[model samples]
Target chain A: MPTKAMFLMIKQMLQRPFTNPFPVKHAPKDVTSLVEKIQKGEVKIHPPVPVPEGFRGKLHYDPERCIGCRLCITVCPANAMEWIPELRKIRHYVSRCMFCALCVDVCPGKKFPGEEKAVKALSMSDEFLIADYDKYSDNLIEEPPEAKEKGI
Target chain B: MAKTTYYIPVGPIHPALKEPIRVEAEVEGEKIVKVDVKRGFAHRGIEYMGMKRNAIQTLYLSERICGICSISHPYAFVIGSEKALGIEAPPRAQYIRTIIAELERIHSHILWLGVIAHEIGFDPLLFWTWKGREKVLDILEAITGNRINYAMYMIGGVRRDLKESHIKALRDMITYYWEFTEHMKEVFLSDPVYKARTRGVAQLSKEMALKLNVVGPTARAAGIRMDVRQDIPYDAYADMDVKAIVPQDIVGEARGDAYDITMVRLYEIEQSLDIIEFCLDNLPEGKILAIPNYVALLNKIKKTEGEAIGAHEAPRGEVIHYLKYDGTRDGPAVWKVIAPSYNNINSWAPLLLGAEVADIPVVVAYIDPCMCCNDRVAVVEDSSGRLLDYSYLHKKAVEKTRKLEKELGVRR
Candidate 1:
C-alpha cells in the first residue's frame, strides 16, 4: 500500500464521480417525458464531448463536384453507395456504411478540367449519431441533388 | 468403493461469460476433480469470409474478427499480404503501426484489468481502472478515428498519419499515464484483498505453461521468457528495445497465479506507454500510407501468388494469420486464423481441475479467453459424462453469487 494510492483513494471518495449525469442533473423516472420536457426547453441536456478534427462520422455528399467516376462506389467497404446511372449520380445508404472512410480517401480531390481548385465530391462530416428505426429513412441517406442539368 | 463424483457444467451461456463457452467440471462436494472446456457457439466463420474476398477486402474483414484485438488481426494480415506481394512498408509506416499496436495494448490490458477485478467481486477497482483506461481510448480515438475497430492498417502502410498535434497529444498522454502506473502497481501488489483472492489461486507452473504452449502474459506470469514482440521483431519493434516482463522480474518469484497475471499486464501497460513515447521521439518522416492508389495495389495483388504466415503479439497473446494467394482468384485460396485463445484453451483444464467452485470465474478469466477470436473451439469431455444445458449453469453461478452476497451481508 503506497501512501499516494491511499491518499488518491480517499480523494476519489471525497470528490464527485468521474461520470457525467447526462440528459439532466438527475436521471428522470421516465425517458419519454424527459425527452418531451427537453423538446419543450424545460430540461437542459449536457452536450456530448466534442469530437477532434478529422473525425470520421456521417457521410456528406457534394454531387456538384462529383465527376460520376464511381471511384467511391468501388472502394466503399460496406457497399454503402449505390450508383444511379439514370441520374448519373450515386446514392449513399448511411445505415449500411461501415464508416471506414476508405471511399473518402479514394475519391479523387482533383480540380475539374477548367476549375482552379480541387474539391472532394464525397467527404465525412462530424455529425455521427444518425441512428434511426427506418433503414430507408430520408435522413439516413445522403443523395444531394446534382447541381448540373440532367443531360449536362 | 470409489467416491461418487458430481458433474457440473458451466457456460456456453452464462451471465459472467460474454462469449459462448462451456466448461464442464466433475466435482466432489465443491472441489473440482476435472474440468473440460467447450466452444463453437460464437463462430461467425471469419476465416471462410477471408478466403472468399480479395486481399484488399479481407484486411477489413480481419479487423472485425475480435473487437478487442481488432488492430492486431489486420496488422498480422497486412504483414502476411505484404510478404506475399514482396513489398515492404516505409520506415515511417512501420513506426506508425508500432505506435498504434502499443496503444491498442494499453487499452486492452487496462480493459482486462477491470474485467478480472470485477470477477473477483471488487467493483471499486474495476471502476477506477476504467477511469484510467479512458485516457488511452482518447489517444486512440484522436489518432485512428475510432476507439474499437480502428480500420487503421493498409497493405503497405497505415491508413492515417500522425501530425505534430497528434504527437503532442500522445506525448502528453504518456507522461500522465506514467504516474497512473505507480498507483496500479500499489493497488495490484499491496491491496490485501486483491492479494488474498488472487495470490496462490489457479496456479499454472512454468513447466505446465511451457508444455501447454500458452503465450503472452499468462505464460509470462509463469516465468516463461516468451514474447512474440521480442522473439521475432515485427514492424518497429525491430528498432525499439523490446523487453519481456515476467513475474519473476517484479515479484521475486513466479507463483503462476492470478495475482502474477495481473502484475504481468500492469507492467505491460507501463511498457507499452514507454514504447509509444520512444516511437514518437524516433518517428521517421515519410509517407504514412504506401500505394497511394488502391487500384494499383489491387492489381498488384491480382498478379502475386504465394503463401505467407504473419504473427503479431496481440495484447492477449499471439495471433497468427496464414494466407495463400492464387494469381487468378479474387481472394486467397486458403485463409486460416489462429488466435491466442486457441492456444491458451489447453491450460484451462489443468488450472481448473483442483480449484473450488467459488473461484471458477477468476480461474476461467486467468487465461483471458477471447473465444470470439477462436470461434470453433470444442470441449473433449469423458465419453460417459452427460451434458447439461444453459439453465443449470446459470443457477449454479447465481448460487455462488448468492453465497458471496450473504457472506458479505449485501443481501437480506
Candidate 2:
C-alpha cells in the first residue's frame, strides 16, 4: 500500500502534460494537421472518392443490369437498401448505409456472371456528409424522370 | 413446483446491459443467490457473413462487430488472412499497425475508465475522463481518415502510409497524454470516494482468475502477467519493447484488488504511450502494402489450407481469433472471437455476489463486458407474464427530454 501510494505520487509528480493552451497556442500535432486538412477541404464529406481494389464504397445499382434479386436488402444490417417494385430496381439511401459491405460480398451474380458484368460495385468515396436530407429521400426509390413525365 | 424461488429477469433489453443482454437474478430478501446471463440479442451472424464474403470484404465486416474495439477485430482478421495466404506485410506497414493498435488501446482504456466512473455514480470523474479521452480521439481522427472505423488495415498490409507530419503528431500526443495522466490519476485513483467504492469491491483471487482463463487487465489485476503482444510477438511488437503490467509488483510490492487492477490499467496506458513513441522513433521505411496482384494472391490463398490462431491484447483483454481456411475464394472460417469479457464474465459472479447494490454497476463495468458481443448465451425474461414494452419506456424517458431541455434553458 505504501509502495502503491509512492508510485501514484511519483507518477503524478514526474508526468509532464502535453495539452496545448487551446486557441492561444497551435493545436496538438494531430489536431493541427486535421484543422489544416479540413480548411483545405482535403477530407471530402460528401460522396468522397473510393479507395481502390476491394474497397467497400457507396452502394452501386444498375437498373439495366437488374435481375431483381432482393439479397442486398435482406442482408443489410442497417436496413439501408430497399427494392423499388414500380421501377423494378434496387435503391440505396447513403445516409442509412452502415458501410458493413454485406451486400457487396453476398451478391451471387458476381459469382456466376452471364454477360453484363453483374451490375454491383462499391467504389470508395469520402463524401459521407449529407448536405440535403431530402435528397436522400428522393433517391430512396428508383424512378426515371421520363417515367414520371410520361405517367405511363 | 416445490416452492420455487421468485425469479427477477433483468435484460435481453435493459439499460444496464450496453447491448441487449438478459440476466436472471434469483433473490430472496435482497440477497442474490443465483444469477444467470442470457445473450444473443446483438449477434448479427458475423461468422455466417464471413463465410459468404471474400477475405478482403471480411476485413470491414469484422470491424463492425463492436464499435469500441473496432480496430482489434479487423487487425486480428487481416492477420489471420495474411497467415492463410502466407503473405507478410512490409516493415513500415507492420510499424503502422503496431502504432495504430496501441493508439486504440489508449482510447479504449480511457473510455472504459470513464464508463466505470459513470456506472459508480461518479459523474465528475466520468466527465473529466471523457474530456481527456478526446485528445486520443483527435489523434485517431488525424491518423486515420475517420474517428471510429479507421479502415487502415488491409489484407497484405495497411491502406494508409504515415507521413513525417504524422510522426510529429504522435510525438506531440505522447507528451500531452503524459500530462493528462496526472489529472486522470488524481480524479480516479487518489479521490477518496473512488478508492472507497472500488478498492475491495470486486475482489477476484489470482487462482480464480487463472482458473477462468481470464485475459487482459482483469487477469493482470489478479497478478497473472499474460499479454498476447509479449507472448506471440506479432507485427512490430516483435521488434518493440513491450511490457506487461502485473499488480503483484508495482514499485516492488504486492497490492492486488479492484483498485490495484485500476492502477494496472493506468500504468499500462503509460507503457502504451512509450511503445507508441518507440514505434514512431524507430519506424522503418518501406512499402505501405504489398504490390496488388489479385490472381497470384488468389491462387496462393486457394492453395493454403490450415488453421492459425491470432491473438491480440485489446484494451478490454486478450482477443483470440482462430481461423481455419481451406484454400478457396470465400473459404469457411470457424472464427472463435474470445473477447476479454468472456473470461471476466464468470469472474463477475464472485465479485458482485455479496456486494452492495450501488457496487453492482461498478463491479460489472470493471470487467468492461462487451455484452453485445457476448449476448449469445443467456436470455432474460420478465416473470410477470406481462412483457414490458421497452420502446414505451424509451418514450417515457424521451418525454422528459423537454423538461431536461427547459432545465438547460432552451426555451428561454
Candidate 3:
C-alpha cells in the first residue's frame, strides 16, 4: 500500500490556514434570458406558403381535404387519432397525443393547406410551458382553442 | 440421495431490482452454483413507436427512453440525424449541449456512488453522496427548466440559451461542488469500512471485461482504456481535449478490480468538472438553430436515405443509437437504441460469480443497473403466504441510527 504519511504532510502544507473571509455571494441570474431575447421578436405568425419542409410542429387535418384515407388512424401510436366512418373525417383527441407527429407527416392528402404548414402558420407564442396534460395533447392539433382562429 | 439444488427467482417484480429483471439462482448450501437473468418487463416497444412517428416527433419519444439519461439519447439522435442530413448546430448550442451533458454525468455518477455506498451498508456515505448530488440537479433545473428531463436539445439546435445570470449560478455551483469533492475524497479514501467492503471484491479481470464487451466505468475499472468521448469524439468533445481516466498509476500498477473501477469513476467526476469549466469559458455566440430554406430542407429530407450509428458516453456507459431513413414521409428513422445498461448488465455475470451472498447486492449495485427506470423493492413472501423474517431490516435500522449519530456530531 502507498504511504499516507508523506501525502498527509504535503496536503497539510498546501492547505490554506483559514477559510476565505468572503461575504455570502448573491444568487446568479437565470440562463433563459438569452433564449427569451431571441424568441421575443414577432415575424410572420404563419406564412401562407406550404409548411416549411422538415418542421415538426402541430398537426392540421382539413375535413374538406380529406380523401377518407385511414392511413393516419392506423399509425397513431398513442391512438389519439380516430377515423369517424360516418363523417368521413378523422377526429383527434388532444388528450392522448404523444406529439410524435406521425399522423401529420404520413397524411396523403394535399387538399386543404397541409397541417404542418398550418402549425407553422400559428405564431411562436412563448407558451412552451405545458402545465396540464390536456394542453400537451392539444398541441398535436392546430385547432385547439388555445391557438388562433385565423385559419379556415 | 444426492443433494438437490434449489432455484430461487428473485425478480421479474421484486424490491431488489429497480427495473424488472428476474434472476434465477441455483443454490447449493449458501453458494450460488448457477445464475440466469431475464429482462424486458419494462420494455414498452419504444422502437416501434419511433418508426410510427415522424423524425421530429421521435425526438420527444427518444428523450423518454430513460429519465436519468434523458438528454443523451435525444442528443445522440439529433446529432446522428444532423450528421445524416449534413447540418451543424450553432456554436452556442454546442456549448449548451456540452454543459447539460456534463451536468447529467455529475448527477448520475453521484447517484451511483450513493447507491454503491448503500449496498455496502454504509448509509452515511449514501446520504452524503445524494445530498451533494442535489446541487447538480438544482443546476440542471435552472438551466434546462426541468430537473430530470431537460428537453433542451432540438434537431437543428437547442431550445434554450445561457444568460450571464446562468453563468453566475454555475460558478456558485462549481464552488460548492469543489468543497463537496474534498469531503467525498476523504470519506472514500480514508473510511476503513468502505475500503474493507470494496477492496478485492467483485474482481473483473481485464481479459474478461474485454471479452464481455463491457462499456463505461465497469470496463474502465478493469483498465480497458475505452470511453466513447475520448475514443470517438462527438459534440464539443472533439473541440476540447478529452482524457480517459485510469487507475492511479502514481500509487502502483493497475490491479483491474472493483476498487480500481470505483476510483476511475470518482476521478472522472473531477475530469468532467474540468471539461465544464473549459466549455463555459469558451462560450460562443451565434444563432442557436440553422434556418434552412423550407423548400431545400423538405426536398433534401424527402430524398435522404441511409443508416448512421451515433454513440455517446452516457453516465452509465456508451449509449448507441442506430438510425435508418428510407425516403419515407416519416423522414428517416428506423431507430434502434442500445443503452449502456445493455453492456453493463451482462458484465454482472462474471463479477457476481464466485462472490459471497452478502456481496451480491453490492456487486450488482456497482453496475448501476437502471432496471428499466423502475426500482421499487417488493416484500418477499414465503410459500405459506407469510412475510419473510425481517432480519436485514433490523440491520438496516441500526445502520441508519449510526448514520444519524454521525450527522448529529455524536461520536459512536
Candidate 4:
C-alpha cells in the first residue's frame, strides 16, 4: 500500500504541477524590469485561475441606477455602508465589506432612462486587488457621482 | 532508581495545534501521567453581536462562526430561524441546500485527512490530498460565488439557484471524489506506516465517547451511530434515508483510534458523494426562496415569536443552534451556538492521560478540534493552586482598578 503511495508521488513528479503559479511562472530578478518587459509584451505572464460567474469580489456601485432606499445599509452585516445624507447616496467601505453581496441582493436594482439593461445599484466586480494602506483610502471607498459633482 | 516526570505544556501556540489551546501533560518518561486541556482562547462574542443585529444580518453572521463548517452553522441557524418563523424553503431550494452541504462535507473530510497526514509528517500525502480537494472548492465557488463563507443560505431559502452548468460541475466533482476516496482508503487504511503511527493512538471507548457527549465522526468512529441527519432529518435529508458511517461497518470491529477516525471520515466522504448524487437525481423545480422579497421575509420574521433548536450533522460533528425570536426584533432575541468541537475536545484530556509524547499530535487532532466557539469564560488559577471563581475575579478586577486609580491619583 505504501508502494502505491510512492508510485502516486513518483507519477506526480513526472506530471505538471496542478496549481497555477500566478503573476509569473518562475522567479525573476529585477522584478520592475520584468514588469516593464511584460507591459511591452516581451514576456508572457502566468495568469491566475479564472474566477467563475458571480464570484464575490470588490463591489461596484452604480450611482446612476441607485434609488438610495438605504436597504443595503440595513442589510449589510459588516455595517460598511455610510449614507451621504445631503446626496441621499451611500458610501461603501471596501475594507470593511465582507463581500457577502447581501447588499447587492437587497439593492432593488433598476433600469435607468434609455437603458435596456437592468443594473443592480451594488454589484460585484472581478477586481479583487483593491487593498490599500489606509482603511478609508480613496480606493476603498465608493463615492457617488453626486458627491464628486459637489466636490464635497 | 525511580523514574522522573516532566511537565510538558503543549500549547497556547504549538505547531501541532491549529488554534490556541493549552494542553498540560505531565509525562512520566514517554507515557503521560496526567493531562489538562485549557481552552477559551478564541471567543468572538458572536452571539452577542447576533442578538444586536436584524434577522438577515444575523443569518450571514452565523455563517461566519467557523470557516469549514460555514454551511453547517448557517444550516442550523436557518433551520432554527425558519422553525421559529414558520417558513419552509421550497423543495428545489431544499435539494440545492443538501447538494451544497454535501459538497462542503466532502471538502472538509478530505481537508481533515490532509491535516492528519501533515501532523504525522506525511507532507506528500497532505499535498496529494489537498490537491484533490481543489475540485470540490472550485465547484463550491461556482455554485455559491465564494469558497469559504458561502453566503448562500437564507432563513426562508437559499440566495442563488443552481444552474445546469453548476449541476454539471457538481456531478464531475462527485465522479472525481469517488476515485479519490478510493485511493485515500487504499493509501491510508492499508499503509503500514500510517497504521503504525495511528493504530491504538487516541483510543476512545464507546462508553467514553458517549460520556464525553462526542458527536459526528468521532463518536461514529467509537461505534456510536449518532448522527443528527439520521436521527432528526432536516431539509432534503428528510426526503432521503441517511445513515451514519461507523468504523465497525468497514473493519468489522471499531478500534475508536485515530486510524478508525481516518476510516470513518473516508467512508463519510463516500456517503456525502452519494447524498449529493441523490439530491441531483431528485432535483425539484420551483423558486429558491419561500418569500422572494427580502423586506417581506424580514417583516414576517419581525411578527414571528417563537423558539426552536436546529441541529445539523456537520463534518466534524453535530452543530446545534438555539434561536428565540421575541416578535419585537427581526432577529432572534437569544442566540446560542453549540459547535461540535466543544464536546469533541472533551475526549482529548482523557485520551491523552496514558498516551505517549509521540502520540500527542494524533490525539490532539483526532477530534478535529476548533477552539473558536469553545471560548466562554476564562478561569484564572492562582499560583497557590486555587481556582478563582468569577466573584473573586471581579473583586480582584475592582482592586486592580482602585490600585491603578491610586497610582494615577485620579478619582471617579
Which regions in candidate 1 have their CA more than 4 angstroms from the true location? Answer: A1-8, A109-114, A144-152, B1-6, B376-412
> Model 2, B148-242: lDDT tens per residue?
78777876778777877778888988999999886677667777767888888787787888787778898888887788888888998998657
Question: Alpha-carbon interface RMSD of model 1?
Answer: 2.1
> What digit string (tens of lDDT, one per residue) describes model 3 on residues A1-152?
44342344356557654322322133326535534643685321322323222323334555655666666665455677665655556666555655444455446564345446422211222223334645434454533232234222
The C-alpha local distance difference test score for the whole of candidate 2 amounts to 0.71
lDDT of 1 by residue, B155-254 (tens): 9998888989999999998988898888888887888878889988989999999899998898999999889899989889998779899988886999
lDDT of 2 at B200: 85
Q: Candidate 4 on B144-198: residue-level lDDT in tens?
A: 9988898999888899999999888888888888898889999998888898999
Candidate achieving the largest TM-score: 4
DockQ of candidate 4 is 0.74
TM-score of 4: 0.93
Ranking of candidates on lDDT, top first: 4, 1, 2, 3
Give the lowest summed-lDDT range of ten residues in model 3 chain A: A118-127
What is the TM-score of each predicted model, taking all chains together?
0.89, 0.72, 0.69, 0.93
DockQ, computed on Cα atoms, for candidate 3: 0.04
Query: In DockQ terms, which candidate is top?
Result: 4
DockQ of each candidate, alpha-carbon based = 0.37, 0.07, 0.04, 0.74
